[model samples]
Target: MDLPRAFTIRESSHRVCNPFTTEKLALLGRAISPSPGTRMLDLACGKGEMLCTWARDHGVSGTGVDISTVFLSAARARAAELGVADRIGFVHGGAAGYVADDPVGIAACVGATWIGSGMPGTVELLRRSLAPGGMMLVGEPYWRREPPDQATVEACHAERKDDFLPLPELLRRFGELGCDVVEMVLADQDSWDRYVAAQWLNIRRWLDANPDDELAAEMRAELAASPVKYATYEREYLGWGVFVLMNH
Candidate 1:
């Protein structure tokens, strides 16, 4: 009834599960403009930051579902801190097969398409919880520019060969899912920095406090190598965004 242990590690490390900064996430949250009183569902809602913020600003009620108990607990505390404890609920369960209890005006699976096998399957998962005319939001990654070479793609954490499509092609894949892209908020370098670099500081502090923990070795190695690898590869080439969609 919890997300895998890897998720807990990532959260403890202050790392984003995906390359979305709080600002970029807020931008996507604002872009959709959920109707007043409309209900929303956030699948794979890591720490529930996006849902809590949206509930505070947009006058909507919702539930956030995640497999990570650690994140669910943090999300619950966050909702309380924001004085929206009753407005948003956090559930600790796998998002892969979960649907909203009620038809929602917006159903989102931000940066967790793998929950449904891939982007298209994730849209189908979201669609089940969406009311007619409701928006479905999917966050995904794409190349900022055509790869200069195979090495560049690999540097971005993608396979050296063709693993991801270009930006337009990625959107086209969504169209093939019977959805129309309604709105989108893309992440820039600044946002990416917040998402990635901030984690380095958090990881460093965690390492200091838990110097001899069994996981320290792995964390330390990742912390030591990630900045160099991310800056050299992902920072320059990979871009991420959340797209709002409606059934075509």
Candidate 2:
């Protein structure tokens, strides 16, 4: 499927729907410390926000790959604004089975594991880019409490047992993938609210400007219904985190 325009517009909007905000970014930085100039790869790097920020702050060079044309344009603009275009690159491509010309010190599939099929597949996907002892970062969601019913999961567009795991099982899955539990930053309800709810205002603004765009109407419909659905369903039942891992 093509990248959704709603996602692209939301990416450029000042909303912080993506998990990589200043707090999360700081946590990710501390977890994946590529040596100076270490090459990094961000799989499904929407809008290149994390890579651009990482390169600028950590002095590492890297590339961000995503299938979203709209987000790629924003990523390019971000790199230019940060003056890191020379040190970093953005590829308009899919993350599934994607690799770099050279080995990278860090490989990440943050919040977009579906690109590699699922969590297990995505771990294998990122490992291909890792040099010996290199790190991989995965962002995922777990169930904070057992959801009372299947409808809650459906509201999040997930099947009853898909895309949501208990935190312990998440760590266990990483261990099964042959990675040590190196570091992790869990997102609380507040952060999850920041991620999902902030989207409403942006979509509202976009809907106001593009009153006639077909996608805007769809977005407006989703936005109007999302807040209550999100709070009662996903937020109450789910847990999320970005975990950094290294081969054992």
lDDT of each: 0.82, 0.81
In order of appearance, the predictions have TM-scores of 0.91, 0.94
Error of 2 at 51 (Å): 1.0
Give candidate 2's TM-score: 0.94
What is candidate 1's CA lDDT for residue 64? 88
Q: RMSDs, each prediction?
A: 2.1, 1.7
- Per-residue lDDT tens digits for candidate 1, residues 68-153, read 87887888888898898888998777899798878999999988888998787889999999999999989888888788988788
Model 1, CA-based lDDT: 0.82
Question: Highest TM-score: which candidate?
Answer: 2
Candidate 1 similarity to native, TM-score: 0.91
- Which residue pairs collide in model 2, if any? none
**Which regions of candidate 2 are displaced past 4 Å?**
14-17
